[model samples]
Every structure is written in C-alpha cells, then in structure tokens.
Target: MRVLLVGAGGVGTAVTRIAARRSFLTHMVVADYDLARAEAAVAALGEQGTRFSARRLDASDQDAVRTALVDERCDVLLNATDPRFVMPLFEAALAAGTHYMDMAMSLSAPHATAPYEECGVKLGDEQFAQAAAWEASDRMALVGMGVEPGLSDVFARYAAEELFDEIEEIGVRDGANLTVEGYDFAPSFSIWTTIEECLNPPVVYEKDRGWFTTAPFSEPEVFEFPEGIGPVECVNVEHEEVLLIPRWVDARRVTFKYGLGDDFIAKLKTLHELGLDATAKVAVPGPDGPVQVSPRDVVAACLPDPATLGDRMTGKTCAGTWVKGTKDGSAREVYLYHVVDNEWSMREYGSQAVVWQTALNPVIALELMATGAWKGSGVLGPEALPPRPFLDLLGAYDSPWGLREER
Candidate 1:
C-alpha cells in the first residue's frame, strides 16, 4: 500500500524504518514543514522495495494536503505531526479518501500562557463534531495511536475482555529514565507536546458518568514493577486512555499516571510554579516589531532537542496498564506490560525506547488496515480493536503483552 507520512521527527523516523522492514509499503513519502528533515529521514531508511520520497507540507493548508494526497495516490495518511494539527490532517485525509492515523489527541497551540481549563471548554463541542463527521465518512481515521494512549488503551481493554469479569479501577503507568551524557534534560517526545500535557489539567473518568478534572501532578504514587526496573514514583497526567476506556468497556474509575525520575519531576514542578508552561502569549519589546511569546515556546527552544539525545541514552522504559476488578465474587488484579531498553532501541533503530514504542503502533495499524484485519470506516482509536489482534501483532515485533495476577 502507498503511505504518506506527515512529520519527520524521531517517532516519524522510527515508524518509517519499521514500515520499510515489514515490506508492506509499496511507495513511502515523508513530508514535513522542514524539507531537509524529510530528506534526511528518507536517506537514512535505505530501503530497496519501498520507493521513498520527501516533500514539504504545511498540514494546516488543506488545499496543499489534498493536492499531495491526489498527486501521491496515497492509500493511507499517517499523521505524526504536532497534536495541534491532528484535526486538520484528519480533515484533509477524509477529503482525499485516505485512511488516517495519529499518535495523540488534537490539542491547542501556543504554550504556557493560556489556562488549560479555558482551552478545554472551548474545544469540547467542536472536537465531538469533528469526530461525528469522520464517523459518518467512508474513510477510517484512528486517533491517539501512540504507546501510552494507543497500546495502553488496548492493554486495558484486553484485561476487561479476557482477564476481569468486572473491572473496578484501571491505571496506566509510563515510566522511563533516559540519561544522555551531555544534555541536562530532554523529553521523550516533542518538547512542545510534552509541555502541553504536563501543564494541562488532567481529566479522569468517573463511574456511571463523564470526566472530572484533577490538577496536573496532583495525585502522586509509587508503583513496584516485577524486575529489571525498580519501583518508580508516578503522578496523574492527562492521557487519552483515561477518557477512552470508559467508552469502550465498563470501568468504574479510570486514570492515567506517568513516572519520571525525581530529578525530572523536580524540574517540572519548578517550571509549573514559575508559570513558564502556560500556552498564552505575553508581549515583549523587539527591534523589528512587538514580540509575543509563550513560556512553553521559550522553554522548548532552550532545551536540548529530544531527537539529539538518542546517542547518549542509556536506560529502560516499562510502561503498561494495571487493572483491578472482581471475578466470581472475588477481587483480582492483572497487569499487562512491556519493557524496552534505551540502549537496545538505539542499537536497532537509532531511537530511544519511548520513541520506539510510540512509533511502532501506526505501522502495525497500517498493515492491519491493509489486510482488512483492522479495517473500518470511521474515526476510532487502537482500543476500539479487539485486544487479541493488536496484542498478537505487537508481540510479533518483540513487544509482547504479559499478564500477571496480583495477590
């Protein structure tokens, strides 16, 4: 199948490599706002059967995206771009009659200034409207197709489907410790997108109802992993799984949590207190004109690029879901997870574990769509699929799902 990938960042590059290795793609085109980045990614792939091409694309430009889809004859459109552009890319893909896939939910632009509550309220109806329209269309669109939002959601569903009779509580944990020699700090994914999630108010699912807001990092807890990786501290972060599991299955309470090393959490707390993670803009004097900047933009510009830290990264990331419920009138717990080492990921794909996990789903989803295993006409997510199909496919790639009963 012909695939047109939007965005050439770390995750995008990882997806491209996997796609080529699978040999499922006949023609592969990588486009980005930065043409040079796209070219670099294409050059690095070095695949024989898949014809690789690079181009410049502004995802917000609907006409340009539509033209590219027609010109490239793209059967599927993979959106690995900024979360802010997800909706626009989806719209373009629908218009062009191509399947769509994305790693995260659509988010607002400009950071560390506007209140997240305000942004969330403003986006509610409009977001649902877009989903409704996509569902009514003939094409398939998958959102939140990354590791945490994507695989984690599937893991939870698997538990609800096969392991538990009545799921009471579900928690998704993402823990990683990535240390690069030179860089003081770096995010696992895009800095701007990370900041958006870190600073936004978390929305957790409530029983027999809808979502309720929680302060970011408000509920901190410690979790113990089986082995290799030790117990790590986690805090609640707004993740899509928290919102999706309730809709897909019968769960009483659902929440998404993330764990960073103590050092990272300390720095994030300091940034939050200083109001540097806001998305709203403030004015400053400039030589050319009045300057407006968001604190997140400044921080993102100052931090070392996450993509550059791959060479020095050494560690492992253990992420998955924990489900608690009852079976035959007795309480039971089951955990489904995967552990990925940064060094190993670097050796195989020149990417960190975080990026590797985030990028793998879209390629697998594409293949499934092509074979008609995951094919459907509507906007959906990875959790919307049967757990076995997705789990079996991911297991083939060495990312297997493990289930253990808790005492």
Candidate 2:
C-alpha cells in the first residue's frame, strides 16, 4: 500500500517513522506546506534507512491535494495536519478514491476567528454528514484517531462490550506528565490546537439533560492514575471524544478532561484575555511597515518548534477512559488505560510520549484496514468499529493498554 502523509510536524514525523517501518507500505510520501520541514522529516528517515520521498503540498488547496493523491497513487491519505486543513484533505481523498485518516475533526470553517459553539456545532459532524457518500464509493475516513479521542473511544467500546452490562458514563481523561527542561512554556502538541480546545467553551453531555456548556476549566477533580503516576487534577474541556462516542454508545453521561496544569491554564487565560487566540488577520506595524498576520499564527510561530522537544522531555502520559456502570446487575467500574514514558519513547521512536502515543496508534488502525482485519465504509470514528482488532495490535508497537477494575 502506498501512503501519502500530509503534514511534517511532530505527529507527522512519528507517523512517518511508523509507516516507513510497516511492511505493507510500498512507498510513502511526506508532504507539507513547508518543503524544508518535509525534507527534514525525510532526511531523518533516511538516516534510519527508511525509504520515503518528500513533496511540497498546499494542504489548504483542494485541487493540490487531489492532484497529489492521483500523481502518487496513494492508497491511504494520512492527514497529520491541523484541524483547519482536515476537510479539504478528506474531500480530496474521497475524490481520488483513497482511504482517509486524521487525528482530529475539521474546523467547520477554516477562517473562523473563534471556536464554534456546542448548541449546533460539533467535531466530525461535517464529515459524518458525508457518511452515505463515502459508503457509496466504498471509501472510509477515520476522524479524531489520536490517543485521547481514538484510544479513549476504543476503550469505551471495549468496556461496553466486555466489562459492563450497561454503561452509565464514559469519562475520557488525558494527563501528560512530561517536562521539557529548557522551556517554562511549551505545548506538547500543536500550539494552535491546544489553544483552541482550552480556550473554547467546554461541552459535556448527560442523558437526562442532553448537551450543555460550561466555562473552560469547569468541574475540576483529582483522580489517581495507575502505576506511580499519582493523582493529577483534571478539568472538563471540549474534545472530540465526547461528541464521537455518543454516536455509538448510549451512555447516560459523556465527558472529557485534560490534566492541564494550573500554571498553563493561567497562561492560556492570559492569551485569551489578550485576544491572541483569534484567527482573524490583523495589521500590525512591522519594521518594514504594516504587516498583516493572524494573532494565533504569530503566537504559534514565536514558540519553540514542538518537533525538537522529544529528547528534553521526561515523564509519562497516562490517558484512558473511566467507565462507570453495572455488570450482571451489580455495580462495577473499570479504568482502561495506556501509559507511555517520554524518555523511553524518545529513545525508541524519536518522539515524546504525548506525540508518540498520539501518532503511532493511527498506524495500527491503518494496518487493520490494509490487512482487511477490519472492514468499514463511510466516515467513522474509532467506536464505530470493533475494538479488539485495533487494541490487540497495540502491544507490538511497544504501547500496550491495561484494564484496572476498581472497587
């Protein structure tokens, strides 16, 4: 299978390394808006003797994406790009008759200055609308396939099928307890995406009340993680898992939280208060005169490149789903979790735990698709398919999930 990956950032780099090692992939194309980043990613791959080619791609342009898919004869289009570029890439993949996979849902409008509200907007809702279209064409697209949305959703499904007679709640929690030595502030993932998810109004769902909104960082609680990670404070945040899981599981409650530290929350609040999260073009006086740029872009550019933080990062990422329900008429709960060590991941995969966990799982999903171990047609999230086939393959990648039944 030929794969065309459409981003060369940290996640893209991790995915490329995994894909290059996959025996099924005949050739891989690493495309990015910046040719240098693409070349850099491929160069690192070359050092590892992983065969890959690089290309300059304007991911925002639909025509360019379609052209690249056709020219490369790509069987799978892995979108490691930001959510802003997701829709066009998916559309292009559909046009070129290629399977599509991405880490998050597309922004409803790429030009929106603020995140969409919960009343009517949702992650992957736009793609879900095209489910019939994809099914008709015998194509498939997986959205929000990263660690939290992807793995957490798979955990929820596994619990529903294996552990619980009736699932009451699916709580997805992500805690990245890693420290990058040189920086007081650095996002483990994309700066733009972190800001969007953190600053936006949080959404949570209850079976009795339906979808509702909360202030960013509401409903704070401390939970103990397994195997020495200890207790970390988590808060309700807007994430795709809440939206996607509800489509498959009829849970009474669905929510997501991230263990973003208080200091980081304060910094994000400052950025929000200063209007630095907006995507609107603003003219600021530059050394050469007036320069037009987006504030969020400026903020992201001024930060250290996320791709270089792997070696300096140390700690573990313990993210999982906490499911509460009854099994065989008795109350039971289980924590389906996966933990990754930052230093170990960096040593093994040249990526931090956060990026390594998020980027590598999609390849497992791809393997299932390639081997026909899993079959589906249409736009689907992780829960829309069988969990064991994907979860069973995790141990091979040095990332295995655990299940802890709590008293």
Candidate 3:
C-alpha cells in the first residue's frame, strides 16, 4: 500500500525504517517542515528499486497536507507530527479519504497548561465526529497509537481480557537512561514535547476521579523491572496512558511513571522551584521591542537535541505496564514490558529505543486497519484494540510482550 508519513523527526525516521523493513509499504512518501531532513531520511532508507520520495510540507497547513495526500494518492496517512498538529492532519486525511493513524491524541497547543477538564472542553468534538465519518466510509482511524499510550494500553487490555476478571490498578512505567558517559543532557523524544510534559502538573486517575500531581521527576521511587533491565529509579510523570486508559476500562486507579536519572531529576526539580518550567510569558528586552518569552521555550532551546543522542547513547530503556488486582477471588499482579537497547537501535534504525518503540506501533496499527484486523469508529486508544495482534507483531520484532504472574 502507498503510505504518506508526515514529520521526519526522530520518531518519524525510525518509523520509516521499520516500515521499509517490513515491506508493508509498496510506495512511500515522507514529508517534513525541514526539507533537508526529509530528504536525508529518504536517502537513508535506500530501498533498492523501491518507490520512495521526500517532500517539504507544513502539516499544520491543511491545504498543503491535502495537496500532498491527493498528489501521492496514498492509501494511508501516518501522522508523526507534533501532537499540536494532529487534528488538522486528521482532517486532511478525512478530506483525502484515506485511513488515518497517529501516535498521540490531538492536543490544542504544544504548551497548553490547563487541567484536563479545561483542555478537554477546548479540544471539542470535531475530531471525533470526523473519525466517525471515516468509520462510516469504512476507513479506520486510531488515536494515541504510540508505545506508552499505545502498547501499554494494549497490555492493560490483554490483562483485563485474559489475565484478570477485574483490574483494579494499572501503572504504566517508562524508564530510559538516555545519558551516556560524555553527554550532559538528552531527552528521549522531542525536546519540546518532553519539556511540556515536565512543566505541566501530572494528571492521573484514581477511583474514577481525576487529579493532578507535581511536575516531572517530582515523586521518585525505585522500581525493579524484569530480568536484564534491572532496578531503576522512576518518578511520577504525565503521559497519555494516565489520561486515556481510565475511560476505556473500569479501574480503581491508573497512573504513569517515568524513570529518570538522579542528575536529570535534580535539574528538573531546580527548574520547577525556580519557576523556569512555566509556560506563561515573561518580558524580555529586545533590540527594537519588548519580547515575551515563555520559560518552556527558553529551556527547550537550551536542551540538547534528542535526535543526536542516538550515536553516543548507551543503555536500554525499559517500558511496560503493571496491573494489580484480584481474579478468581485471589490477589494477582501482572507485569507486561519491553526492554530496548539504545546502541542496538542505532545500529538498526539510526535512532534510539524511545523513538523506535513510539514509531513502530503506528505502522502496525495501520497494517491492521488496512487488513480489516482493526476497524472501528470514533476516538480510541491502544487499549481499545485487540492486544493479540499487537502482541504478535511486537514479538515478530523481538520486542515481545512479557507476562508475569504475581501472587
């Protein structure tokens, strides 16, 4: 099938590599705001005798995205853009009458800081309505199709479906040591998105009530993962799973934790206390006029590019979900997780684990939709899809989903 992939960033690059390797894509068109980056990715793909081209397009511009879709005549549109531009890309897909899949739910703005309640109102229902229309046309659209909200959500579904009669708590943990011996600072994914997550108050679900927690790296704990990855310190952080999973499954509590090194945590804590994580603008003197700059923007500028860390990056990232509750009148706990090696990922895809995992899921979801394995209407997360297909796909790539029974 012909597929059009937007955004040539780290995740997009990794996704392209995985898609190319699977031969799922007969013809591929990669687009990015930065033409050079898009061209670089296309050249890197080096699919011998395969149809591939790179284009420069601003995905935020509906007309531009529509034109590219129509020109390419793509059967599927894989959106790998920033979350802020997801809705518009979805609209473009609908206008182009193609199957749609994205890595995250549509966000109103990149730096929006309001609580979920307020943010939900602003997001409105247009996107869902569009998705329903696509479903009526027999075209499928899957939202929040990344590793955390994507696979972690699927893991939760697998447990609820087969492992437990009822699930009480779902804890999604993502831990990665992106730091090597030389690099001082590096984030796993997009620096801008990472900073936004770090600055915002973590929204979590407990007993069906939504609540907020402190900033990133605020609440710290040591979590012992399965064999190989070992014990790593994690902190309660905001993730799409914490926001979307509770709505799909009946659960007492749902939370997401991210593992960060001690030094990274200290830097975040210092920034939080100093109010440097704020999204609100502060006056700054300029040459000709007074400029308003948000702390998030400034900090994002100061951070190292996550894409560059793939080469120097060492260590593995352990990401998975934990479900604790009772089944058959007995207490039970199940952990489903994956461990990705950074160096290995670079050798394979020229990217890191975080990017590889995030990028791989959308392609899998698209294949399912194309093959009638996952076809549905309305807004849905990874948990809404059957986990077996996804689990099998992960296994094919050696990123198998593991299950452990705890008494």
Candidate 4:
C-alpha cells in the first residue's frame, strides 16, 4: 500500500525507518515543511529503490497537504507531525479520501493562553471535532496510537477482557529513566509537546462523577516497574487515555502519570514562574532596539533536538497500564508493561526507545488497517478495537512485554 508520511522530526524519523522495513508499505512519500530533513530521512533508510521518495509539504497548509495526498495516490495518510497540525492534516486526509492515523492526540496551539492553557479539557474529542463527518464518509482516523496512550490503552482492555472481572482502577505510568551522556537537558520526544503537557493542569476521570482537573504534577506517587527501572515518581498529567478509556470500560479511577524527575520538574516550574511558556511574542531590547520572540519558542530552540539524542541516550523508558481489581472474586493487581532500552533501540531503529516505541505502534496499526484486520469508521482510540490481534502483531517487534502479578 502507498502511505503518505508527514513530518520528519524524531518521531517522524523513527516512523520512516520502521515503515521502510515493513513489506506491506511498498511506496512511501516522506513529507515535511523542512524539505532537507525529509530528504535526509529517506536517505537514512539506505534503500535503493523507488519504494521510498521525499517531498516538501507544509502540513499546516490545507491545499499543500491535500495536494500531496492526492498526487501521491496514497492509500493511507500517516500524521507523524506535531499535534498542533493534527486537524489540518486530518482534514486533508478526508479531502483526499484516505484513511488516517496519528501517534498522539492534539495539543492547544503552542502559543495558546488562558482557557486552553489549562489542558484540562477533553483535548482528544475537541481535536477530532469532525469525527461524525469522517464516520459519514466511512473513513477512519486512529487517534493517540503512541506508546503511552496507545499500548497502555490496549493493555487496559486486555486486562478487562482477560485478567479482571470487576475493574476498580487503571493507572498508566510512564517513566523516562535515561541519561543522555553529555547533554544536561534533553527531551526524548517532542520538546514542545513535553512542555505543553507538563506545564498545564492535569486531568483524571472517575466513575459516575466523570472528568475533573488536578494541578500539573499533582499527587506524586512512585511506581516500581517490572524491568527493574525501580521506583520512580509518577505525577498526574493530562493524557488522552484518561479521557478515552472511561468511555469504553467501567472504572472508578483512571489516571496518567509521567516520571519527570525533580530536576526537570523544578526547571519546568521555573519556566512557568518566569512566564516562558507564553505563546505571545514580546519585544526585547536588542542591539537594534526591539526584537520580537516568544519566550516559549526561545526555550524550545535552546534545548537539544530530541531526534539528536538517540546515540547519546542510554537507559530505559518503561510505560504500561497497572490494573487493580477483582478477578473471579479474588482481589488482584497486574502490571502490563513494555520496556525499551535506549541503546538497543538506537542500534536497531536509529531511534531512542521513547521515539521507537511510540512511532512503531501507528505503523503496525496501519498494517492491520491495510490488511483489513482493523476496520472502523470515524475517530477511535486504542480501546475501541480488539486488543488481542493488535498486541499479537506488536509482538513481532520482540520488545520486552509481559504481565506481572502483584497480588
């Protein structure tokens, strides 16, 4: 199948690497606003064939995105770009009459202020506002198919279906316990996204009561993962699964947490306290008097690009769903986790685990979709589909995944 791959950032780069190796994806067009990066991504594959090609695309531009899809005759449009451009690319997909998939859900525009700043709203639902229209057209948009929200959501369903009878709560914990050698500060994924998700107030969902808000990094709890990542502080964050899972399963409490260490936490708080997260541009007195810049953008520009961290990054990132409830009248708790080593992942896919794990899932989901194993219309999260086949297919990658009984 011909696939239209957009954006060539770290995640996008990893997606390209994995897609190049997939036999089902015979043709791929790697498009990005930064044309050089797109071409570099294609070159990195080292494949000498017309199966892979590069093109320049302004995914945010409606006409550009639609033209690329239509011209390429892509069977599916895979959005590996920033969440901010999700709607435009999705609209383009619908306009091009192709199925679509995105690794993560959308974010309020980077420079958003006040209301949307809270990040406590149902971001996923709001992002794909045209779900009904997609449904009407019989096209599919798989949302939040990344590592944390994607696999964690599917693990929850697997627990509900195969492990638990009376489910009480499902908590998704993501820990990035890695070291980037020489860099003092580097994000494994999108720096813009990392800032936005952590800088805003977090959200949680409860049975009957519905959704409610919490402070960013509130209610810090330490969880010890199975692969000996040890106990790491996991603080609440506004993740899409917390909003999506409750719609399909009955649970009293659902939450998402990130293991951002004290240093990162302190630094983020400082950025917020200094108002560096603001999207609005301001004039700074420079050599020529007034120069305009967004403090947030300035901060992001100063940090190391996450894509460059693969070789230098060392350690593991463990993310999964921890389910606690009753099974056949016996109280039980099971942790379904995926652990990825930065070094190995970098060697194999030329991507760090954080990028490798998230980027790979959506490609696999597309494999299922193209092969007719996964069929659905409109927008959907991981739990909306059957978990068995997806997880079974995911096993082909041979990353470490297993269930642990903490009874």
Q: lDDT scores for all predictions?
A: 0.78, 0.86, 0.76, 0.83
lDDT tens readout by residue for model 1, 108-165:
3322444433224422223445766666776777777888788888888788778889
Top TM-score hit: 2
Write candidate 3's Cα lDDT for 207-289 as tens digits: 74564454445567787777567778887766778766776777888888877667776787788788887768999999998
Q: What is the lDDT of residue 377 in candidate 4?
A: 90
lDDT value for candidate 2? 0.86
- How far is 265's C-alpha from truth in model 4 (Å)? 0.5
lDDT of 4 by residue, 156-204 (tens): 8889998989899999988867888888778777767877789766777
Residue 93 Cα positional deviation in candidate 4, in Å, after optimal superposition = 1.2
Q: Name the runs in model 1 displaced over 4 angstroms.
A: 108-127, 282-292
TM-score of each: 0.92, 0.95, 0.88, 0.94
Screening candidate 3 with a backbone cut-off below 3 angstroms (N, C-alpha, C), the clashing residue pairs are: none
Worst 10 residues of 3 by lDDT: 116-125
lDDT score, candidate 1, position 124: 23
Q: What C-alpha RMSD separates each model from the true structure?
A: 2.9, 2.3, 3.3, 2.5
* Better structure of 3 and 4 per TM-score: 4
Residue 228 of candidate 2: its Cα lDDT?
Answer: 75
Deviation in angstroms for 327 in model 3? Answer: 2.5
lDDT of 4: 0.83
